[model samples]
Each structure stands twice: as structure tokens, then as C-alpha cells.
Target: MIKKITIVAGISVVLLATACKTKDLKMNAAQKETVSNKKEVVYQVFTRLFGNKNTSNKPWGTFEENGVGKFNDFTDTALQEIKDLGVTYIWYTGVPHHALIRDYTAIGISNDDPDVVKGRAGSPYAVKDYYNVNPDLAVNPANRLQEFEALIARTHQAGLKVIIDIVPNHIARKYEGKNNPKNVTDFGANDDVTVEYKRDNNFYYIPNKHFEVPDTEKALNGEENPLIDGKFEEYPAKWTGNGSRLAKPDRNDWYETVKVNYGIRPDGSKDFPELPAGFDTKSYKEHFDFWKGKDVPDSWKKFKDIALYWTDKGVDGFRYDMAEMVPYEFWSYMNSAIKVKNPNAFLLAEVYNPNEYRNYIRLGKMDYLYDKVETYDKLKDVIRGKSLPDGLSDIQNGMADIEHHMLHFLDNHDEQRLASPEFAGTPEKGKPLMVVSTTISTSPTMIYFGQEVGEAGNENAGFGTHSRTSIFDYVGVPNHQRWMNGGKFDGGQLSQSEKDLRDFYKRLLNFSLKSAALMGKYQEIQTVNRHETQGYDSGIYAFLRWSDTEKLLVVTNFSWLTTSNFEIKIPSYIMQKWNLKDGNYTLTDQLYHKSAIQLQVLNGVGKAHITIAPSESFIYQL
Candidate 1:
């Protein structure tokens, strides 16, 4: 009988039974669970593909000119293109109504912002309405449901799930409804205010009668009239009632967003003259309820449903923008709603350094956050020949942490593209490194739209649309172009370098998909002298990842100029299982397909000595 043990809290408990039946049974159950939760691969795309640009295909700049808005056009071609890539999930960024009535300084055109513009109306992030889709996106208004159903069907047909972007932090400032600046109502009385509001315990409002100030001055400065003796005062500062000076909090300089009053005065002061007792706090909900339909309570509900609407339309998951800034309660509600809609829906939050904020995992919330510290900062240093402080031990610990949770990517829309030489090294040298780092990391990988093609630009330090490279340009301008090239117009073909990178990524992605060791849950297997070879003092890095069925040893020679020979002993379990002699094994180069086993005696001990090339990596499978 096989011995069985129950492992809980990372501890194995042996039930002191003479029989091993229970232990074997529990181990089998654990293995089954592990196999069932294998990680999946996701591909991201910007949805401008389904729309057209007026400048390139003039006269038909609107949806009418391009037959792409219909489901047949996208499903027939676009779906097939993505499906061929062998990705399991697709994340579509922003397909909602981003129309705004701002004057276009570029073309001097003044109208409700058209969906088609030459750098006129930028990205879908500038959403004007949460309840509707951009007219250009859905050509026949009546066919919205039909288009969604078809898109979903095609995506399912292609064997991929879909995810959409959900922005809940703020709405476009151009909205002119009941929530607009003009419709000044009782402050904090109705929850349906158009502007974003907060409900912390520190907010207070001045009465109109408390002070006197010019309208222009009042407009420039966000000050309201004061209330004196329950009457509006001409000047707020001159109010003679038992009131305190209104204070605003000092805003942080790093963030570009306006801060909402967390129910507090800016100056950290509390309400001085209290309002009448028994004031209904339920009135707070009214501000958020603005523009909400009969069944919906607020714009967030509509926004949440819009996310589901896209998932229902054939998108698999969401990459939630500014997920941390949104109220946790809202995320909880959204996750629950999504679970009911689709249990398999994958949610990836754009949170930076989640290890610092573990609260994001509190039940039924964001499933994945960008693992910035370990993947980007630490791992990048190791790859780029920088000495690690904790050395190889840190790499092992980092991989262990990554294995416990869902981690997304190193490069995203908000940051500089990974293809940039600064991050990846010049394309020639960096492409190989990028492949090594991304594939070897413990988490499932994510590559931005143009990352596969060596696209480069820094959007982080104020680089705009004009500065960034376009993937559409590389693939040759599809008849339906959604990108703006040089001269502020669309239709630019891809350069030769872009094509090379795209092909390289195609190979890397396919290889990753085919590897069971990459997709399956990983266990860290011990290698002899693990502390010495993977020393905290030495810059050398090595680790082993094993599935329940197979094992792979990864070793990276971190030095850029020095070629060193390191002796390693294979673990007894691994050596015995692989039918090796004297507990010794040789390293092999997976990239070059070469065997690297050479036996030698070091310090009177038999060890497998292998020479490493400068800045090289090796993988041996047993």
C-alpha cells in the first residue's frame, strides 16, 4: 500500500496509520486539483480595429465608409487572425462611447466629438457616457445585440475568451447633464451629483449666504457661498455665524487626478456648526444615482454591466484601470456580478506592487495584479547584469511568491513598452533576454499589442500619441485602419524591424504554450549546494521547477564578461528517478540544443562540472 499524508498549511501530517491507503488517496486528490488549475495564456488588443479613420479612407471616415463595424467583418477575419496565435484569452481595451463636445484645435472643427479624428478624439479612455457605445463602434444601432452575439460566437469559435477594460475612477468633465456644474443643488444632499464624490467622515459644505465674492473669482477658486443664520451670505469669509474657516487638503503632486472630499474639509477640520439631528444619510446615494436607469442605482452599476456586456459580447475578462483607487466595495460588487455572469471570467487588475497591498485579494475581488516589485524591478536587474542584493535566494523567493497568486506583466499601456532598449537592451541583444525572462518567470505572461514587434516609445514621461510606434503600421495597414501615423493621419505600413520582432514573438508564444512545465503548477526541487551555487553572496542564479510528472533545471550565468565553471550535484530523488549514476547530471543548452555534461573531481568530491558562456542560460530536463 502507498503511504498517504494530508498536507495543509504547507505541513504534511502523517496519521500514524500502519496502512498507507489514506496518504495515497489524499496525494491523488491534491494532484488532481493541481492539474485542474493550470494557468492560461491571454492576448491583449486595442479595439480601434473595429472602426475606421476618416483621413486615410476619406469621405467614409464614419462607420458607413468602412464595412468593419458589422460583426461579419470582424468575426470572419480578425477572429481568425487572433485564434491562429493560440492565445486562450483576449483583452479588448475600451469599446464604449468616448464622444465629447470639445472643440478640435487641430482641425478647427467644433461639434460633438466624432469617433473618427486625426489625433482629434484620442483614446477610448476619454469616455463621455457610461451607458452607450460609440456610434462608430456599433454601425446599425438596432444590430447592437446581434453584433455582440456574433462577436462572442466567433471568439468562442476561435477557442479564446474575451475581456474588456472598465474605468470607474472618473467620468469625462464635458458631460452637461443634471450632474453638470450649472445645476447647483443642495451640497451633498442628493447622491446623484454628476461629479465624483466621497463619503468619508470629514466632509463639510459652506452655505451660500456666508460670504461675498465675484462670480469670476468664485469660478477660478473652488469656493462656495457661506451660510449665515440659515441664510445665504454675500461673502463667505465675512460670515458672522458660529462657523469655522473652510480648509482644503493639500493635494499630492504625483497624481494628475483631482481629489474627492472624503467627507472632510481640506484643512483636516470637522463640521463646526452641526446640522439638525436625524439628517438622512441615505441622501448620499442620490449623487451616484444620477443618469441611472430604473433598475440601476448609479453609473458604476451601468459601467459594471457594460463590462459584462462586453464579456457577453464575446470578450473573456477585464483589465480594470486604476483598480486600487476605486472603492473596494465597488470591486466586490463587480466581482460578484461577474461570477454570476461567467464563472470562468478572468480579471486582471492594473495594480502596481500588490505585495505591498495584500488586501486586494480579499474574497471575490481582483484575481490578478501586476507584480511590479518582483517581476519588473528585481528580475529586470538580474537579466540586465546588475548584482542582486539577496542574490539567487531572492530569485527563488520571488518565484515562490509569484506561484502563490496571479501576476500579469512587466510592460503595459501606462508604462514604456518593453521593446525599448532601456528595458530590453537594443532589439538584437534584448529580444533573447526578453524571451528568457518572460518565459521563465512563474506567472502567466502578458505582452502588449506592439511588444511582439520590437516597438519602442516612452509614454511614461509625457510622450503622446505622436511619439509611440504603431503595430498596425508593421502588419501593413489593414483596409480598415484605426491608427494615426506621422502627419497626424492613418495608414502607415510596418517597418522591416517590426516584422522580425513579430515573428520572434510568434515563436516564443508558441513555445510557451507547448511547455507543460511553464503552464502547470511548479514545485521547487533542491539541487546540491543550492545555497552555495545559488549563493546570496554570488551573483549566479539557478532554480528548478518540476511538475508532478517532469522536472526542469534552470541556471543563468549572470556575468556579462566572465565565463565560469560551476560544479553541481543532482538531488538523490531526481538522480534515482532519472536512472542517473552516482547522483550526477549534466546541464544542456536548450537554446542551442547541446549537451553540456563533463565529470570532474572538485575538493575530492565527484561533481558535474559545466562551463557557462558569458551572460548565458541553460535548462536541463530529466
Candidate 2:
């Protein structure tokens, strides 16, 4: 038998050094408390595509042709390898039973029309059943739920938590809940479809109008299917998921789904009760009490029940899709109920509006929200030379109150790959961004599965042909497949650059996971350095993170082509905080440990003359 090469094999030395240094630091009571609060590192893998070994990625291919991965594919060894990468939660995306075009009539699943589905596999957001797992991911379609339960159990055994999606904004256009429990009924089952909006109704209806599919040729995307007839039967058309009121929604709209009415009328008026003043500062238990005996919307109760059901089934958390589109009041009721069930549940939301960040965190009780518009967009511009790195300081400082509630990521299922030609043109450019984002604040770090292996999701997989990995089709990720290595969970086929990239992630994530300073005080030093240092310009970003015991000087060079030699200084206030006098202190890089650099302190100021390679970053430990 051939030896399996784990992701930890190359970076074991660096991790060991980090562990030893952590013990050597003289931590105070507060710093020790901060060290105990370990930072979360989320590893998001599209469950359907994670274990598929098939490389025959035919465009618009059926499950049989492309070979869909099953629940059994996440074997113990595969999960252990993921755990070794310093992941705390494995977000098993696309686990819910979504609308797909496959025929499962043998087991009571209705065939969906291609006109109403995004691709042959369909979008994961358009859920058909909330009570069951996707049959496509099970060896036996009838026992799909059992297979997923086993996966949840196996994940717990591997010392990791699990997170799944709960899209509150919509449901599939053709929802068939054959697996719903006896106590639970299908959405819109008791709806009065004659009315446009009702407090008790599950969906908003367009009375006296019939549902019409989009243009057949455009919906099919040049794919041949027997069910593409440009028709779907409905007595009254419902509002599209994106709030489109048209009987036939446009091709760009969320046409595969219908919006779930949360006591909001069509005239931009809310029918739900607004949370009272000072409720934002209340605890989840208190918020849970506030909704007691209140006549809440029917959709709110149904989604809350769905969330509790999953909590009972060992699901550790949820990732709410398009959270901003839904009302914050509904989130208060729903998330409060979830917290009452599992206080430790990881509740993450995708709220992009900068103004609503505090409302979602405080009012909605969300544990984390996507830091996309500010941190992610600004960092992308910095890498492309369109924006300066100093701009990040303002964004971080602006959200300092809720910085820990913001989750950072370079690539996700919705975003373009870092290695794609349209993005950075190479994964090497992500090094500086990764270091800065990971160590910037107390926020949690998220990494999509193939990001470590440098996967450029540029494949033309039918309906999804952008630089992003297709969540709407059956396709294989080429770079991820190399690391899969025939289910050995090893990097046997990874190139040298891929191996190096993966090693860098392993070191940085592991260090971030245990470092006390990451969860401590932060001060951006980029502006001060630009004015004081000769070579330090907008192309360079610098910051300081410290606790009672440990201090970290983080610097990254975003310039893609040239080496930057700059003189970095620790300010007088920070020197006073550390109580340093005129002497030389050794600063070691946490990621590479290339060499020990010297920081000289004179007149209550510390300075280090540094030369950094293009796209290189260092987390210097003092």
C-alpha cells in the first residue's frame, strides 16, 4: 500500500513551534481568558461535489453520467484530514432536498420541469423539502435522511461541528414534501390563495392570474429535456423569490423559487410587530420571551419549527441565505428560538448592507455576518491595484463594535476563485490578503474547500459558466480532485505550488486558531508607517495585534511585481502599553519562520527595517 500524504506533513514544524511559543508567553488573567476563547475556522464544502472522484465533467450532464457523490463519500479518514487543517466547523452545504430535474417516481418524488430549474442538478437555494436530505446524495433514495444522520454522527466523532443551509426567503416553485413528518405540514397547505397577502398565509399570491414559466429556449439554456414546455400549473401566480410580481418572471430573477411571505404586504408595509426600544441590548432568552403570546406570522413559526427540528437532529448551526431580503423582526423571533434550543449554535447570515450590520447582529441575534462589501471588496481592489491597502483601516475601525460578528473569506460558492484569470490570475496573490484577513480582528475566518488547493472554478458547466464553482450543476472541481487523490484524502497529485499554498494555509489557520492576540486588541499602523517610513506606501499594509502576553506585528505587501523595503515602527502609546525601553527585540514570523528580525526601541519608539517579497506577509511574534 502506498503511503498517504496528509496536509500536515509539510507544516508540522511550524505548528509545533507555535504550540511551544504559546506556552512560553506570560499570560495575565484576561489574556488567559482570551486564549480559552478559541477562534472559529469554518471549512465550507459543497456536500454534493466534495467527494466526487469523477473527472468526466460533461456540460449539462446527468447524475449517472457525471457520477454524483454520496453521503458515504465523507469517510472518517476524509473528515480527519479536514480536521487536521484547523477547521472547527464543516459547513455541509446543499444537504437539504432541493428541486432537481432527475426522475425519482419509483420512490414518490415528482419530476421537476427544466424550465423551473437552473440546471439538471438545480440550485441548492430552491429547496423542495425541508424535512429530508437530498436523495441524490444517498445510495438508497428512500433512506436519504438516515444517510445524512450518519454523516452528522460521523462528523461529531471526528471532533468537528456541522452547519447546513436554511434559506428563509423562498422555496422551490414545485415543492413536494413527501417526507414531511405527520405533525409537520407542507408550506402553503392551508393558505387562502385568493388573497394577495394574509398574516397567516405562507406565501404572497397574485390572485386571478395563473403561473407562467419563462421563455422555453432561454430557460433550458440549449439543453434538451422532455419537460421543457414553458408551462407550470397554478391557479394563481405567486410572487417570485426576488419579490418580482410578474406572472412570468424574467430570466435573471430567482424564477425557480417563490417568495415566502413573512407578514409583509406588497406595499412595503410590515404587518409583523416591531421589536421595542432597547431590545437590541437584550439577551436571546429575553428576546425569546418578548415574542411569547404575540400573534407572529405563520411563516415565522414554520421556519422556527424547521430550525428546531434540525437542532434536534444534531445540526450545530445554519447559514441563512439572502438574509437581508428577509425582515429583521422575523429573524429576531426565529433566531431567538434557535438560541433557546442550542445556545452554542453557529448562526451566520449573508447581510451585505453596511447600515444593517448592527441591526442584524444585535436585533436579529446573529452570531456572524458576511464582511463582503467592506473587507472583501476592498481587499480584492488592493490586490488588483485599484484601491490602497490603507482604506481597510477605516472599514475595520468603523465596524469595531461588531467586528467579531463579521466573517471573512476570499472565496465562497458565490464569489470568483482567487486563482481565476478574471480575479488575481494566480493563487500566489492570495498570500498577503489571507494573512491580513485572517489576523485582522476577532472575526471568524471562512475558507471554501478548494481554496487551499488553488482551485480555479472556470469550467463551463452548463448553466453556471462563470469563474465561480457551479452550485447549479453536476460538475467536478479539477484542482480539488487532485488533492482528493482517489479518496485517499491526501495531496499525492498536488503540484509544488499547490502544496506550498496548502501548507501556508495550514500554518496560518492553526496559529490563528490558538493565538490570544487575534481575539484581543487591534490597532492599524498603516497610516502612521506611510508618513514615517521611506519605502512604505499605499501598496503596503500594516497592523498591530496584542494581548497581555503576546504581541503580533502583521504586514503584507499587495504589490504584485516588486519587492517592498520599508521601515515599520511601533508607536509610542503601544510601546508604553508593552513597557519597552531602548533595546533590541527579536520578532519571528509565525507563518514562515524564515529568520528572526530585530526591532530596535529608542526614545520610547520601536522601529524595524523590513524587506518583503511581492505578495508576501508575515505575522511577527514578539
Candidate 3:
């Protein structure tokens, strides 16, 4: 019989027959104050592709033909231009050395087989070496670490913090840590190969089972490669990254990577020591102290060291990939260590499970998590005309307790481009959506590199298809290259429409960055207006944000080709909160500053007569 593990509400996780438990955590006043400060804007750029100027986008192209961007390309001039976009932090994605098809055998780096690697440039998530930088991103392969360090120094000089990816759930199929510290060793190096599960084992082995690559005839998709031999050498196959226990994982599985064992046996019972009750309410320093002399899993210590190693190297933050896959206890151990090193390190996580949000944030010590499943997905549906904007209220109200810990973004590497035919079909459609997303809360905002200028991402770059930028293949982002303008870092080649779109982003981002009301109190006025006003509907959304001195009334029209002219009514409850009297006030559109309207307050109820253009958004201040 298969044993099932159940997590009890408001208590702890029942690990089958074990006495382990995970306690819930609440956000303290200090953490709340930290999030309520200035709205930090994070600009996520694919580091290897950000400064690449080549436009020859050949399918399945080699690194020589489709030249890669070097670390030196992020010059002071280029970084300053990015900083001028109101970006407080720059997430340089794909910095760690991962498995790729390129040859570095001359420098003692083994060539990765093309059969296991995703594309000419391997997936950034399948990291091979956590200690070193990607050789392909350096002008000289041997000096990759120095090049990255120089880039880090340059980034700091330009007045911006740096963030990089730390994928802890799994690692590349073939692990090679050539530049690891002498004290640290490779994962699974000291493990016993014959056992299925052990408390100290780094990996769960299959005993006598030998590994076999997936049996997919279209593995290469007709691309000719000399290394496509349909075989890899593994004595006893370990589990796949996606938790496949079979000796051969399916083609769709994360076959290029292997899962790391964190003292969780094959039967779902934890072998390591669990946290004591009420650890969730403790500070990171307390959490770090709790693990001082306790015996923990090998993988936990290894990942913690890796994080501290980078933190010591001057990295300001980390973006943990697929954080939910790892145990909650491990994050408490890992993130607490990071905090002890740098108290202000920006620790962002990718957690999709809504039930575990509090667990990761309060218990795991994560600073921010991706608000994709709630805010981003719902907004995308509204933008695509698949749903009404009425449901957005439910999402915001539901996350009221942890709203500030959620990070909002309209575009990222994993999602389809806003301008692509598969998405909104035009860059202009994102304007209203972006306004609602960025101003709706106290959460930080993130934007992909090409999102500002409308990169459609419609290219067939080998292993990747249209509608999303290729992270696996060696390809130049065409629309992004136009903004690059041959390393000038100016939008010299952008069309008039593209230029206008970028200008819109610059204006909105800067405004959000400086606005104090955005990080203050929020109340939804859309529901009240839809019932009391004549023309307000589900297609239009309205809200109010207020601080002690500043008051803002935000409205957005989600309908395309349909203009909205209505008397937006603000409830008496909000009017009392803003402490407004029964009098006339001038309401000016903060964006574009094109028009000012009359806001008449009568009987403690404020009413604004406004006209919102199709797909237009307004941030009106009193």
C-alpha cells in the first residue's frame, strides 16, 4: 500500500508515520514596514542575450554564427541607460555555468553531449556548475569568473543592485564544478551507489538499474548533430528532476537534470530533523541559530554554502527557481544563512501553490514571490478578452494579508510576449494592463528587457517555437536588438510606435517609483461605481490609494475600441478615510497630464465626471 502525507490546516505537515511538523508564520511589523517603503522596480534581462547585437537569427545556429553577448557588453553607459528606466535592481538571468553543446575541452571543461542538452545554448535552469559563470558569456572562457565580477562592480557603480538565478531543485545530468572551493565538493560524489535511500545520501539510487536516455526518434527534430547517439553512461540511474523514479524519464520530463535529495525518502517521509513549533514567527537570526549544531541533510548544507558563496561575491539578491519543489525546512535553512550574510538581500522565489505562500514567506524567510497564478494570470485573461475584470477584486482582497510580499509583472522569459499574436496582438493593449498591475498594490514590479519596446518574440529558434523568446537556442531577439541599436544602447532603430510605447513605460515606471500613495492604503471602488453609476461596467475598473498627504484615484478601461464616459462614484467610506469635505476639487490625470476634470463632493460622497479612452488608464490626484 502507498502511504500518503497530509498537511493539517493551522498546524503542521503529517509526514506519514513521522512526528514532523511545519508551523505557520505571520508577517511581523518590521517586515511589513520594509515592504511598504519605495516600490522597488526589478528589470529582468537575459544576461547572455541582453547586449548581443547580432541579427543573424538562424535556426539551430552555432555560437560562432549567432554570436553571444559578453559580460563586458554591459558597459557603464548601457547600465546607466537601464537605471534611468527607474529600475532599482537588475535581474541578470543565466549567469551560472550550465550545460551547453559548445566545446571547452582545451580548458579542462568537458563538452556536454547534445543529446542531453536542450539546444546549442542549454536551458539556464539546467545549471551544471553553481560555483562558476557560463563560459559562453565571457570573451575569454578561462576568465569567465573575473568577467562576471567586473560586471557586478560596474552594475554597482551604475547605482543598481544585482539579482541572479539560483535553481536549487535540481542540477544538470552531468555535474562538473571545476571552480568550486577546495573545501566544498561536488554533489553525490561521496554517496553509496547501491542504496535506494539513505539519510546522508546526496541522491536516491535505483540499486542495479542502469540509466537510458529517452527513446524519442525526433529527439533532435531533424537537426544534424554528431553527439546524438541516443545513449548516456550512468551506472545506477537516480531520480529525474521532475521526480520520475524510473530508470528512463520521458522526453517531456526534465531529462537533462537530476533531482537532489534533501533527506526526504522515496516514501515521502522526511529523514532529517523538523523545525520546532513557532519557528515561523522567529527572525532569520533566530532561525540561523536554531540550526547551529543540528544534523541536517547534505543537500541543504551544500545549497546554503552556494548561496553564501555568491552573497560574499557581492550579489545583492537571488531569484530561486521552482522553490515549491523543495521542502519548506530547507529554505528556512538556506535563506536564513543568506540573511545573516546580507540582511537586505532581495530574496525572490517562484512558488505557484497558493496554499504554500505563507509557508514560503513567513516560514521559509523568502522576501518576495511571483504573483503569477493570481494577479498575472487573471490580468492576462482580461487582456486577452477571455474574462471580465470583476474577478481581479477577489484576488487582491484574498491576498490582503500578504499583498506586499507578492511581486507583480506583465511579462517575463517564461511567459509569451505581450505584443505577440498569441497574446494581446499589439503592444498598445498592455498599457492599461500594466497600469493596473503596477499601481494595484505595494508589491514590487518587474519587467522583461524587451517588454518596454514591444518584442513580439515570434522567432523559430531551433528547439523553441514562436510566441516566447528562446532560452535554449542560440538566437538573437530581433525587436530587442532594435533597442540595442548595435551596442549604442539607444533606441536608434525603433519605429515611431515602438518609441511611443517605450516612452509610456518610462513615464509610468518613474511615476510609480516616486509615488508614496502606491505603498500606502488601497481600497477597491470598482464594485461601488458599477452599481451606483450609469456607465460603469465589468470592463472598467477603479480603485483608490491614499497616504497621509497624497490621494490617488486610479481607473482603467479594459475594452478595446470602446470609450467609457461615466461619473465614477467614490464611496462615502473612502471619502471619510481621505477626510474630504463636501466641496469641489480639481482632479488631474497624472499620466500624460493632458486633462483636468471636476471632482464634486456632495453629502460626503465624491463623484468624478471622466472620459477614459479605449484601453486607457488614469491616475488622478486630488
Candidate 4:
């Protein structure tokens, strides 16, 4: 059996490489070609809370407060709020239609189906249409396109970019049209009679069977004449649904979504009517003419035009939903098209495990993705004081591998909050642990709206009056009126504890945004084990980040008690390069405005010993 091996390194050596081999390894040669590209800060907003007039109406209400209305109103206050928070880009979630049927249950207006709706707004992942906005979400139903354009312009005016969600994997079942069955196309058949569907045309199609590996291989391999049995076959084939490719209802069970067909019509074919009912084959032909010889299906080709249209409309970028489900070719094509219209457009893929698929970076597929393994696995272990094989070295390496951008967060909408003890010990310990993890990680960070405010219920927050995990407090509403009247008022009313955490977050965000060393590429300066200090070897880790112009050292003690008489060896290169004559350096506290650098050298080895409190984190700058 072949085994996979990974190499992890300590911080001190990593920094030494940066200092000595600065020019040799600035960025990969290909990445160096694009180093002039500017980095952006993306602030993800739950659109309903930010400004959805149909949802609520208070001070932070939906475009109207006490009957006063303004044009392009929803974004006016919300943009100002985010701009104050120092975010450069705004990522709006769920701007498109939620469901095609308009059933109240789909949007949480009714709570009949727990699987489909649980008194919470449906997951925006279930897209109704690629081309239309949700009517309920729009300020003006008839002028949605104009209103959306105005929203994009307003965001740009605020010196912020905009990125809307794009769900390419599946379209809502109802949106395919009422006449269409869940599996069969509107023509009462599972497949359309495109050239790919005709046996004589050399395209592969599966009979009766749902998507499977054999069918997919046949389509991709361009088999002349492929046949398959239920048992293992000598040759396999790829699958391509004629015109019914996009009409497939069940995304979870389908393999075609993993590798969509990219077939072109043959030689000036006109008036091909063997398409699924309600689908205009002529329109598809006209559209396919734009791409000419592109091998991908007509449905997949539409994405390029859609992306370009939005880019030209001033939408900055896209966060591809379930990006891995789509092919890399699609991402490359869409990214190129988006960049053509807006060069600075930021594309972040919702990839859960990026480390396993790091090659996607070179394809220009995504600028950033959610780093789940590091945040959930490694960070979780550290806070719990478990014996990690390489201690915090794994985190240091993970930070280094993030080539373009990596979003650092302790919790997100899809997962349980880090505040939950099931993952990070206890809320009391988890809060500080999260603060340290989110702040110190060498990636652009993201804080879910309610995280800083300590909204604890991890259960789904209802859309109506009985929400357990309400974001009303974060949106600045009184708890009494927020729950009773269902988020009616919003003049920045917050509980004392919520207010304290919010203030801390504001300070932290401002500090982080202002620091180039934190956002820029990092070079680890040092790492220390616990034996060097009195009772320090238990559960503590220290490291540093330095650029040519700036240097920062971070020390964290993940214990529940005061660490007494701990000594750490300072790297000789750092000591000599910084020119510390007395074997000591100035310590500037990043969290609290405090400064202290006094230390005694042991036998001229340039080692310093200090005491740290429980759950304490310190940052020293040189």
C-alpha cells in the first residue's frame, strides 16, 4: 500500500529561510507574475439582517424606518456600518430566489417540513433561478435589474466591492418548470435527443439508470460504441444527458454534476427540435454559437455569460457554492471572464478541505476557501491541551501553504460555534481560545455576525417570532422587543456582555486591518517547547511573523492556571539581526496597550523567562 507522508517544520527555521532566501522564494514563479495583484478584505453579510426591507423595519430596518423610504435605501446604513468596520468588500448571501414554488414553507413562512424548513430562511444553496432575483428580496419587483445595479454602484461608492453567491451545481426543482417531473424532463423522458444522445453520433448515454461512474467515463472518453452490464465491464464510459443535463432534480445522488458534459452540435445543424419540453433548442443553438467550438454542454456555457454580465454590472466577484462539485474548467473559464470585466474581482470558493486539493490555486479557480481541517482539528486539539504530535507546528505549516488567501474563522453558519464546549472545551475557555486562533492565524479572518456578540444557541435560528439564536442583538435591537415583536427596532441596543465583546471585536478588527505584517505573507520567527520554563511545558506555544519591514512575535499559554518561571530560547539569528546589545528586546502588547521588554540573559545565551496567566496570549513587536 502507498502511504502519504507530510513534513512539518518549526517556526525558527522557517523565519531563517525567509531572512536568508527572501528573493529566491518570495512566491512561486507563476504566483510572482501576479504579485502586483492587490489583496482585498471581504466582509460577508447576511443580507436579511443588513438590509432586506421585506424582512424587518426598525432603525436598522429594511430600507424604511417609521414609513420613511429612500432610493437604494437598504444599503445606505449597512454600507456605512461595514465601511466603519474597515471591510473592503461586501459578500451578500442569498440575493437570488430561494425557491421557485413560492410556498411559504420554503422561505420559513410556515414550519411544516423540518428537512425543508424549520422556521428559518431556507439555505440559499437551493437556488431557484440563475438569472432572476428573489421577488420578496427586491425593493422593486419590476425594476429588479436596475435596483441590483444600483446596489452594486452604492457598494462601489462606499469604497467597497460586492460579491454575490452563485450556485451552479443545481437549480431548484420547481424552477425547471411545473410540468417537469423530478427525474424525467418535460418531454416525459429521462434524456433529450441531442447529437450526444443519438447512438449514431458517437456520444454516450445511459439507459434508465441514474448517473453512475461507467456512464460518466463513456461520455468523457468519447467511446465509439460502448455497452455496459451491471457487473464489471472491460471498458467504461462517461455520461452526458442530452438537453436534460441541467434539469436533473436530485443533486446529491447525481454524478453528472461532478463532471458535466461539454458537447457541441455538429456542422451547421439548424431546427433541432428533439429537446426537452419548454427548453428552447433554438435559443441554446444561438447561445452555443457564441462559444463556437467549446466542448462543454450548452447549459454549462451559459455560466460564462452570466458571470460576465454580473461583473460588468459592478458586482466585484463570486463565492462559488459547492465549488468542488463543478469542474475546474468551469471555474477557470468563469474566472477569466470575470477578470476581463473587473480585474480586481475576488473569487472565493466554498471548499471545505482545501489542503487536499491545493492544485486548484494554480488554475485560477479560487482566491480563498474555508480551511476546515486546521480550524476544527488542529486548533481544537491545542485548546484542549491534547498531546499533538508536532504541537503547533502543523498550524505553522498550514499557514505557510495558503498561497493566495485563506479565510480564518472559529465558526460559520454551517457549523457549530467554537463557543460550544463539545468542540473547544467550554464557552469561558472557548471565547478566549477563539479570539487567539482567529487573530493570530496568518490568513484574512472572517467573523460571523453573531460570533463576537456571544449568541450561544447553535440550533437553527427561526425566521419568525420564536428564534432561539437571534441576530437581533448583533443588529442592535433590545432583547425584549427583538424577540417579542420579532426584530422590530434597531437603534444599536445590545446587552452589556454583547456590547463588551462587540467593542473588543471592533478594536481587534481595526488593529488587524491596520497591520500589514498580519495581512501580508508571514515568516515564522521561532517556536518553543515547555521544558524551558517552570511548569511551562504543559500546554503553551510561541511563534513569530516577520517581513522585511515589520516583525511580530506571539506567545500563547493554553492552560487554566498561571504559568510560573517559564524560560524560552531566543533564536540567535533574530537576536543578532535585530541588534539586541543587552540580549533583550522591547515587547509591545497587541491586545492591551502595554509595553515591557526587560529580561535577564542566562550565560549570554539570550534566553528569557516569564510568567503567563491562564488562557493568556501576548504579542511582541520589534
RMSD of each: 13.0, 6.4, 8.5, 12.2
The residue-by-residue lDDT of candidate 3 on 1-622, one tens digit each, is 2222211101000000111122112347535423436799999999888878878888888787877888998999889989998889999999999999888999889988777788779999999999999999999989999999999999999999999999999999898988789888899988988898887777778889988898664544656667778888887998889889889999888889998899988889988878898877788888889889989988898999899999999999999999999988999899888888888899999999999998998788889999999999987777676777777889988998788899999889899987887877788877777888888888899999999999989888888868999898888988778988988888999999888888888888888898877776677877778888998755677776666657777777776665667887888876776677899887666766766688888999988777766555555555
Query: How well is each residue in 1-622 modelled by candidate 2, as lDDT tens digits?
Result: 2222111000011111111122222223322221125589999999999988888888877787887888998999999989999899999999999998788889988888888888888899999999998999999999999999999999999999999999999999988777777777789999999999898899999999998887644554766667776788877999999999999888788989999999888888999899999877778888889999999888898899889999999999999999998999999899889888887888999999999988887888888899999999988877765667787899988887778888999999999997787766788877777877888888889999999989989788888867999998888988988999999988988999898889888988988888877777778888788898887755677887776667777777776666667678879887877777788877776667776678888999988878776655555665
Off by over 4 Å in 4: 1-26, 32-40, 51-75, 100-120, 176-294, 353-356, 384-391, 398-403, 425-442, 458-491, 519-527, 560-565, 595-611, 614-618
Give the TM-score (vs. native) of candidate 1: 0.61
Clash pairs detected, candidate 3: none
**lDDT per residue as tens, model 4, 1-622:** 2222221111110011123112122345433332223334566655544432232322222223212122254455656656666566777766765542123343333211212211123445555445655544455555655677788888888887788888665543223222122332221123343323431222234444443232222221231212222222111222322224322323233322222332333222321222223222122222233334545444444566667656766777888876765555455556655654565667777776554345445454356677666655666665555544234555656556454456666655555555554555334355445544544544556665455555454332223122223322122212222221222323255666555555555555665666544544443333444434445444455565544445555555555544334566656665555344554444555555554454444434455555565434444443
* Candidate 2 minimal-lDDT segment of 10 residues: 7-16
lDDT of each: 0.42, 0.82, 0.82, 0.46
Over 400-442, each residue of candidate 1 has an lDDT whose tens digit, in order, gives 5334344646455555555465654444334434443544544
Q: Over all chains combined, what TM-score does candidate 3 have? A: 0.94
- Give, for candidate 3, the lowest lDDT window spanning 10 residues: 9-18
Q: How accurate is candidate 3 locally (lDDT)?
A: 0.82
Q: What is the RMSD, in Å, between candidate 1 and the native fold over all Cα?
A: 13.0
